[model samples]
Target chain A: MLKFTCPYCGIEASETELAAGGEAHLKRYGPGSSEQDFEGYLFLRKNPKGVHLERWRHVMGCGKWFLAARHTATLEVFGTYSAQTHEPPAEIIENIRAKFPEWQA
Target chain B: MSDPRSAVGGAVYEGYVTVKDSGAHGMITLRGDHAELAEAVKAAVGSGMPTQRRIEGGLGGGAAWASPDELLLFCDYADAAGALEKARKSLEGNHFLVADVSDARAVFALEGSGIRDLLAKLCPADLSPEALPHGEFRRSHLGQVAAAFWLESEETATVICFRSVAPYVYDLLSEAVKGGPIGIF
Candidate 1:
């Protein structure tokens, strides 16, 4: 079972206490956008085998949502950050870059 | 005026630990900037504002941090209205929301040496002495419902959950303690 430290509450919560929210940093394509962009936004997702970012909610703890970066294959967690930001924080990006030199943000 | 009634009607259960309804407790859900809330909380409950995941005073009259921008203030059930009024008046010009939620919630007292073991069975939080020491407040799931709890001392804890789920939560606690101490703690 995966354990994640909630960035908001500073508690290490198990997978049972959290609700996964698919991918993170998703850019919504609203009205006036092309059908292709909307389709990609709604259905397409990056299935990287390496470092990936995802959104998780501490449903049983502080009930706050946060973002986490981890390796999909190795299950090595890079870091967790507040959900208020649109992109990963500089520190998390640096941490990920340090481990996976060829990985792009 | 009508007398207030607790959600469980003062239910009590005896097993490895004692589970009893703590009766009606005044609770207010306060949400806003913490800086503005500090003054409001002090004015309402005569206690300092709580830090992250902590309670500032005793359960009789204290403030517990519920979230980044929210606090759960406790007081006497009879004084809920007055306390809420004071909080609102103190935060009149600030962007804040405060409400008396005493009737909307249920409180239970768990007493015994197996308090941690009983709670550890239901909650995902680390209930060890070092992790959830006295005065530390935790909001998490108890069984399937959302619940919040804090240690009153080495052997006592106060747990609160929605009034609608009082029976469910009470049963969960009562059953969890029926088999005697787990001795994991």
Candidate 2:
């Protein structure tokens, strides 16, 4: 029953209308990299209990992909941003830091 | 040339709400810079570019914001090729993609006093007047299929979905209409 505000279309979409894309912001390691780096890039995930950043596709809404920062345990969303960026916006990072001072990116 | 046929062969159903196939609309999927696309769209459809998640114009011809960089431009079925040609010609020398997708989609017109209530049964979008006012287009799912809809007025809406799912969507709408209004609106 989770709901997300689509950053692209500005619609509050229910979970049923979206598709989860696992964790976000991993530095992709390609063919030239070491096996360990590639494996980590493909399989390793933070799976953090709190303050998680994930990718979501508004499949049914705007059909655009976006990144969301939220607390895993509380399901409190910090913010959503365009998927084209390499990292979360500074404002969202600042907001998360304000709420969880000890948390690190 | 063979006459174009719609997916549902122009089906119609009447219950608490009326659902009918809006046969053979010309749809163009345009992808590029919004500002540039706007000018090309005007040339193709003679309608202004739609704002985010909104549709500008009517069932005859118009543009709907499909995404930040994409638009769904629709016009008369016979004019699809001409419209696509116009858009491409206008966007020449620019990085853009335009295609005539008229046959790939199916459109349905829903009309009744219970339009909102009937749509709410299948779509997760907020169909309230304030949220989905006239001209505001919403790209959402109907039941489990990808669908988009826009309200033409308080009791009228136009829906579009993949042509492959036309029969499925028609059935869904017909069944929902038969369920009678929940009176939520």
Candidate 3:
């Protein structure tokens, strides 16, 4: 059983509490403006089998929206942070920074 | 001390237990101004205000910070006086509400590889490692009463339900341990 640390509720839940909502941070092709964009949305996935920042829901329990960074192959989850949380868990951000050194707004 | 926590499945296997208390410890409530109270508490105890994980070691005692403004502290059993005095001396007259919770609830710690599986059978909340990593806790219905699971490790968790429901939870786990199958994870 895999677990994700919910930053808000502060409980580690089994994968059962969470719902994978599709590729996290998914970018639409021109804001739902074209059919090709819709098709791309429906059929495309980088599926990079690496650490990914994706949307998760505490569906069966907390019923909250959160972001989770996970290692797909091993399912080594670092943590989960609320979507509304701006400060973001420092440890996770650091890991992200290490992976994508140039990551910036 | 094994954390004064009763492990269900009775040490039958490595981490499984046969029977155990649902809530093993007492939880106290404190209401005060966060800034002044927290600082004074820190000075008095050595460390207070649990910021991470379950069971925060206090400046003068111990507690589990259940929420941002809520904490569960105790001064009963092994170090009752020490814990109580520590809390009293530090913020006694500084406008705080302290109460004894020795019998308000009971607690239990569920350990071993089969924890996720057994809890899944008893609890509706997700106990999967991917969904809940660790250092997680929540209060919800365990069968009929309000129970909580404090994730201590990937394989171990502390369960807390009311004293009234203690027997039921204990029976539930005991049956799960003996009558149920094992969780491979």
Q: Could you say which candidate leads in DockQ?
A: 2
The ten-residue window of minimal lDDT in model 1 chain B covers B58-67
lDDT of 2 by residue, A1-105 (tens): 578899988999998999999998889899899999999998988988999999999988778899999999999999999898898899999999999999777
DockQ of 2: 0.85
Model 3 Cα displacement at B158 (Å)?
2.3
Better model by DockQ, 2 or 3?
A: 2
**Residue A26 displacement in candidate 2 (angstroms):** 0.3
Give the poorly placed runs of model 3, Cα more than 4 Å off: A1-105, B1-18, B22-27, B33-48, B52-54, B57-61, B74-78, B182-185
- Best candidate according to lDDT: 2
Model 3, A1-105: lDDT tens per residue? Answer: 678876656766667556787656555666646988777777886576666677887654445678887777878776677686554478887876786665431
Lowest lDDT block of 10, candidate 2 chain A:
A1-10
Off by over 4 Å in 1: none
Better of 1 and 2 by lDDT: 2
- Cα deviation at A29, candidate 1, in Å, is 1.5
What does candidate 2's lDDT look like per residue over B1-185, in tens digits?
A: 67999999989999878999988889999999897887798899999989888899976889999899999998998999999999999999999999989889999999888989999999899998889888898988999899999888877889999999999999999999989899998
**Model 2: which residue pairs collide?**
none
TM-scores, one per candidate: 0.95, 0.96, 0.51
Error of 1 at B174 (Å): 1.1
lDDT for residue B167 in candidate 2, whole number 0-100: 97
| Candidate 3 C-alpha lDDT tens digits along B143-167 | 6556666666666677766666666
